[model samples]
Target: MEFKKFKLFEQMKPTIRKEFIFLLFAALITGGCRKIFDLPKEKDYLSNNINFSNKIFEPILGRTNLMGGFNADNSTMPMKFEIVNARFGDGRPVTDLFQKAPTYVWTTAYNGLEKSLEEIEAKRKLEEHALFEIRSSGEFIMWASANNSLIKPRPADSTNFPQDTRYFDLKITNSGGQTVIKDLQVRPWRERPYEPSNDMNLYTGGPAPDPDFPNNPNTRDYIRPFMSNVIGDATDVNLGTNDDENDVIVYIRPFTGGNGHSLRFKVLNKDSVAINPAAFNETKWDKLVHGFNMQKTTEYVQYDVAYPIPLVEVPTAYAPGGSRAHAELKYSRIGFGGGRVVATFGIDFAIYKKGDWEIVFHFKKDNPKFQND
Candidate 1:
């Protein structure tokens, strides 16, 4: 029996060794492997309550805060009453006062309160209410005895009388539920107008009989104005359909000699479209440039040049009287252009003589067409 047991032990020994080697190889191959459980669920940071409140009431509350505030006097007494602890049918508080109250309520509640505080402060400082009574001819006067304690009585013929008074008709309700209907008036306190020594009418061009231009007569001659072509020979240039050509003209008119004489001109299209600054490209012959030189000669001659293509700038200059003429300008194009350019040109002449200056201008229409957009 002992011999048989030994022989069985010997047989099982190899089998056991084989199993140990297989287990060792398997452990080496899967040594770093790990089992993964589900990660903890992520938490949401934003709550629904905060989002709902912002969407509904934030904007309304912001406007209410701006529209209603303490009066200018910093008084705790609110000019307008806000109903607290109030709710709508849905149990939401009333945050908007502008929509709930009438239109006049806004001005009366806010503006009226401000004005009342200002008036009170002014009366306290200057010892007078700047209140003025209205007269039949739209004039105003500060009543002497009415504000006597706060203000001294003015003479019956005080020159500083109020000239223009703006009155606002309003009805106000206080927090205490007291209603007051009143007319608020603003007084205009402006300086006196300087009266001229001589009568000068702007409608008719003439000199005033003052010391500056004494005995100076109106030398301006109203002539039949003609559109003179100064640059290119385009007496009958046909601009293609939906296109335009520019021509410059110098208008010469006589006037009393003065300093700082100059002219300003503006062109308007046929459809009453003002020539926007872009049509004068350097490559286009349709655009024109103009200049005037009085120092070179008494003649107010205008030099006009037409560009074969549209240009960005035009070179030009002008002078004042015959002695020291000093004026300059550069014309440039702006905006897209299409067929047919109809323009109205305007000129304003400014001339100074004997310490006096005069201004005049001519209004004329010019229409020229081109072929493309």
Candidate 2:
């Protein structure tokens, strides 16, 4: 019996050794997996709430607009962002978005103190950029090369369908792994060029859609508001969409001739006659802007200045808000109530295109009352 038991133990020894070796190999794999990754795991580290501030990306044609305000709560830095599966609403591929085009890329840091357009242009170099691309940290840019032919927006007519509302997916990758954000909208419209672009909407080169008109004593000024009251005055000061009604319309006209780097301001009364700049007694024409060599005429007031007003969007002696160039025109006189009434017309504007531009403030209904009632 002892001899038989010894033989059985010898046979079990081989199986036991083999099992031990298999368990040891499995433990080595488990230990090696623990030391594999340096960064956080995609599920563990990446925030589930990472999203955009605005869902609808409405990029105006002929210009680059930043699609910013990405909320990445507790997400790792240097996370790669990519635009993927871009297509139109009709399920067609947006191949043009992937193609590269010439773009103004900043070579050096812009301090906003650059004097001329040439100086401004010098700091930037024309580089090939994708029409629609996302930066690694997730700031999406719609390049100026995106035109109406490529990305069509909702037309001015209500009956027309939105031809091409581009849709795309965003892929964000970290060291651990990648996660994809699905189905982002890109609805682009035509450019209105300058702001105070209230006159047009769904700007499809059609008869301006639902024009926004403002009343006299223009509310553009928030500090010292305009005061006006005419009891017996018969001026058409109605701010309406009526074709006949004439509100003080400010027209920005660019000229290719005679000192391209200049801005001239003109005011016309109801009868198509130019108003004397002296009539606006309260306006400090010289201090109104940061222009040099101010030339005032009975017909117009000219300023030899930089092409784009407020060269950089910073609060200065010229631009108070660090955005648009603000101009307030004030003229005071006695009213029917024996009180000092002031008629003020203020405009805040910016010119992007480089040329001699003229701003005409036409009081269409009638001439402003400068005489006591």
The candidate scoring highest on lDDT is: 2
Clashes of each: 37, 0
Instruction: Give lDDT for model 2.
Output: 0.67
lDDT of 2 by residue, 11-90 (tens): 77787968867888898766655566544333535777888887778777656667877888888777888788888778
* lDDT score at residue 178, model 1, on the 0-100 scale: 31
TM-scores of all models?
0.17, 0.68
Residue-level lDDT of model 1, residues 1-373, one tens digit each, is 9999768667777879679678877886565233234344333232111111111111111011111111222222333321233233334442222122211111122111222223322332222322332222222233221222322222223333322222232222333333322333222211111111123322222322333444566422231212221111132342221112223322322234433332222333334443433432222212121222322122222222111101111222321231222222222222136334332222222222112121112222334332232
Query: Cα lDDT of model 1 overall?
Result: 0.26
Please give the lDDT score at residue 337 for candidate 2. 87
lDDT of each: 0.26, 0.67
